[model samples]
Target: MTLPMQVPIPGLPARVRIHEVGPRDGLQNEKATVPTAVKADFVRRLAEAGLTTVEATSFVHPEWVPQLADAEELFPQVAALPVALPVLVPNERGLDRALALGARRVAVFASATESFAKANLNRTVDESLAMFAPVVARAKAAGVHVRGYLSMCFGDPWEGAVPVPRVVRVCRALLDLGCDELSLGDTIGVATPGHVTALLDELTGQGVPVDAVGVHFHDTYGQALANTLAALQRGVTTVDASAGGLGGCPFAKSATGNLATEDLVWMLRGLGVETGVDLDRLVATSVWMAAHLNRPSPSRTVRALSPTHHQEQ
Candidate 1:
């Protein structure tokens, strides 16, 4: 696919790996119960669009996230896809459900701020980490790759610009759990470039391998792409992006869509960075999803490139 435009960005990697989260993170916020088949097709289309790591679904309790209640049925449909399907497991029960359906990769989420931990997970920071310790271990022992997600790593709504050390503590605990990687999240989309650098610096000082780190940014303040560039310059390889810029934290009422995969791919392509994603197909998938939900996608790249993006009313 041809790129929309190009602008030189210094100190960027030649290639970046985008961990597609639209299927889970993006759709969970939607009130509509997306059909199980639609979710499966979304993942499959993401793979066809050249996204290798599509987060397929979450194994959270149905009461908590009704959209993902079909995890049991969802996994079997996409289990054989030639891509990494990592499901979010809130605890051992979630892991059990994932494992039963042949899930080979899983993710555990924790909050850097105590307030968010209490609000989102109904547990304190330590309690959440303690719960994940054995889940990570047993999952690893079962040969499943585990990823740790530390939310509010940059700034928390209740706490305001979070302290690096506080975020680091959660990161260390996750690392201790033998997580294959850590996906630091800017849950409120308040992070700036400086915060991104400082956090990565501190994480490195604490002996956390930079290579084992990824970033998840929200576009609430329209800083997701700028912050993404900051992380990329700091050697972060994995980035979490939602197709058509879909989804936000249910807890963060003010937050917006994630850094759009289309926008990121557009910027990376301009910098001559290889993502291996078919931008045209990716936008098409997002467009199809938007139609299903009776809305236009929020992605700038999708809007700019779509032939019928803004149809005459």
Candidate 2:
């Protein structure tokens, strides 16, 4: 498919809100569990670097994600950090756990396809949405803001390309369920610029306010940055990213990390968009996290700026 050339949008907002998911979404798939102190410190550094919204941890079952087994302890430590720290709760049990730990914000997720929903949560789409109703109500009653996630919005690994209507349906359900905002995810990183534009256009046409939506893209095929630009042009002001470009879906086998926070900030700043994040500090944090994980960063900008062995000479 032929893609349109990206045209920079003029007169856009000077700053954008970046919801950092590194601590939770970013590390969930890692084989080694990050220490609680290390995780808490990572979050503190992120806040110190001007990240206001950070996903601190997931309150899912330890058996499902052993990496976050310390959620109970981790949440309390980070919750006192004086920032907007949200945790992902998969169901009522997770929500109850988060509430007991004094979580201020909670996120619930639903997949756009039957195959993905079953694979990721072992429930059908309707069933997942049904489970969120009481969770959202309980969260609202507790004076907590609830964020909804629609995974595999662009394509699913098992089912291939998903239809626009399906994505819209799931998004509408989440919004109707009283989520403060809904984040649409390119779960497998299969979205191109055209696909993103088309989806946003349809969603907007359906009367879903642009401000109520956020975009989450993966770099699996290297299209994440391009897709992000497309979303911005369409007036999406909120974005989901991970520090050091960490995270991928356990269900989407070949998926890569979420779009890197540094790369996104670099591009946004170049376009005169404000993300309220310090690029240099974020780069430093990414480097630290990558070292802790003992893996190379997936951020292109970070890799380019760092001196290689040849450069050191």
Return the TM-score for each candidate structure: 0.97, 0.94
lDDT of 2: 0.88
Tens digit per residue, CA lDDT, model 2, 1-313: 1112334468566668999999999999787899999999999999988899999999999988899999998887877787899999999999999999889899998999999899888899999999899999999988999999999999988889999999999999998898999999999999999999999999999999999999999998999989988888888889999998899976678788999998888787777776678777787788888888887787877776564512332
Instruction: Looking at model 1, report the run of 10 residues with the lowest lDDT sum.
Output: 304-313
Which run of 10 residues does model 2 get worst, by summed lDDT? 1-10
lDDT of 2 at 225: 89
RMSD of each: 1.4, 4.2
Q: Rate the local accuracy (lDDT) of all candidates.
A: 0.91, 0.88
List candidate 1 stretches off by more than 4 Å. Answer: 5-10
Clashing pairs in 2: 14-274, 15-274, 16-274
Question: What is the lDDT, from 0 to 100, of the residue 112 in candidate 1?
Answer: 96
lDDT by residue (tens digit), candidate 1, 1-313: 4565767677888789999999999999997889999989999999999999999999999999998889898899999999999999999999998899899999999999999999989999999899999899999999999999999998877888899999998899899889999999999899999999999999999999988999999998889999999999888989999998999988777677899999999988888888999998999998888888777888888888885774721
